[model samples]
Target: MRNYLIAGIAMAATFATTPAFAKDVIVQMKNQGAAGAMVFEPAFIQAMPGDTVKFVPTDKSHSAQTIAAMLPAGVAPVIGKPNQEMSIKVDKPGIYGIECKPHTSMGMVALIQVGKGPSANLGAARTVKLPPLAAKRMTPLLAKAR
Candidate 1:
């Protein structure tokens, strides 16, 4: 009976001390064909600690690389080629920046903000805001080129 009681206590302790794995978020990189540049859609992402962020490439020639020391400790993203997916598990709460090696100057960049809550701000501030152009007037002009 004593052995059974001890076993039960051990099992309960194990269950209580186990850590939970992080959840995954998906991010995609796209190529718009304007140039040989990698573009990250939505540019900014937010998550909590222990969350995993997966980077998916939609461009054939682009890859992702995490900026060293940009992220919190233990939060380094896996970087790879196009059509390949990599993930970063955020253990600490902070902002992280990722960029494509081939097109870092062409704006192939993204940012992830991880924290205890959903209040952390990630990504660089937008510097330019173009006025909304009339799509109806622009469509005919663009169509003529095609």
Candidate 2:
């Protein structure tokens, strides 16, 4: 009986930790040095609710911030500075637009599509139109391959 109880407890622990090990996608925000504006690689990412998304900075003076009212309540990310990383565990099914505060006007915005419902296209289907300035700066960055 003692051995059986121990085995059961172990199994329970494993089950409890299984969900926490789900795969995470690491997205990068490129700083572009001084040639151009920073840009998020892929420009858009698709993730399931509960999945973790890590934003890594690839240049200096760059940061990630979720535009107010762009994400559902409780889904906003905690903004951080360059070289620093920020993570968000998407818990709701919807589209989110994230940008670098100072660069948004220069097209430093990207999209995050969470959960499986409706369209999943990050740009064409659920476009988060950016300001002309922001879009212009992002043009060059978007052309480079990851």
Candidate 3:
């Protein structure tokens, strides 16, 4: 019984010292009728693994989706429907590219950086194709990490 009690205390200590709990980050997809006005607020975000990202559409006609080609090899794809709240749990450490399908041409894209250090597949992520404006907008955002 004494051994079991000690083991219980050790386990409890382990949990207590660990990084608390996961958090949720919100991303808003805003729509503006004017060309180039539709975009994602805070186009770049840094998060930890196991965090949740909730994509909210703050205006008419917008959707958030993962850019498949830009995701880490093993990560799952996410595609959010218009005007609906979509939540995604991030379990990988890497950069994730998000886009608003209808507005991608107008630079409606975002990026999420999870965890620390570097991900194994960053090379693959850079290969993703984006619209002219999207690519232009992401250039500085991506460079900020370096």
Candidate 4:
């Protein structure tokens, strides 16, 4: 019983100091989803740094790419081909805006929040002038960052 207690304490300490495991989050691009037509299901994603976001094309003619003005500082731009799967690892803390190039006018967009820290580029992201429909869709997503 004494040996078991020591082992348990050691294990508890080990786990307490261990870093959180990175997670893989999936965002599906669909022509028709819970949100209606031309949408990325669960359009808003909250994640921590080091997590990976996988964009899966569930319908034809759907693609994923970063809105240059919404990109985080020091991070490379991500562009995904239509009907293809693309994965992006979140290494910095900020807000990232993703859109389906061909369908952006129809409001196919997604927002990724990496880390809980306030985004330094949120203002820049808000300044990007998207098409009417896309801007309307992004309004609420950006509101979540605050």
Q: Which stretches of candidate 1 lie over 4 Å from their true place?
A: 1-21, 33-37, 73-78, 116-146
Ranking by lDDT: 4, 3, 2, 1
Cα lDDT tens digits, model 2, 12-87, are: 9998656565568887777663335567775767777778778787766667877654565555556767567777
Residue 102's lDDT in candidate 1: 68
For model 2, the stretches where C-alpha displacement exceeds 4 angstroms are 1-21, 33-36, 73-77, 119-130, 135-146
Worst 10 residues of 3 by lDDT: 31-40
Top candidate on lDDT is 4
| lDDT tens readout by residue for model 1, 20-139 | 645788877778633233566656666667788787887677777776635455555556665677677766776666766666656676667676433232222121121222222222
The C-alpha TM-scores of every prediction are: 0.58, 0.64, 0.83, 0.85
Candidate 3 local lDDT, residue 18? 58
lDDT at residue 38 of model 3 (Cα atoms)? 81
lDDT of each: 0.58, 0.65, 0.80, 0.90
Clash counts per candidate, in order, are 0, 5, 0, 0
Ranking by TM-score: 4, 3, 2, 1
Residue 127, model 2: lDDT of 38
Clashes of 2: 5
- Residue by residue across 76-131, what tens digits does model 3's lDDT show? 99988877887878888888888888888989988888877475656666667788
Against the true structure, whose TM-score is highest? 4
* Two-way lDDT contest, 2 vs 3, winner: 3
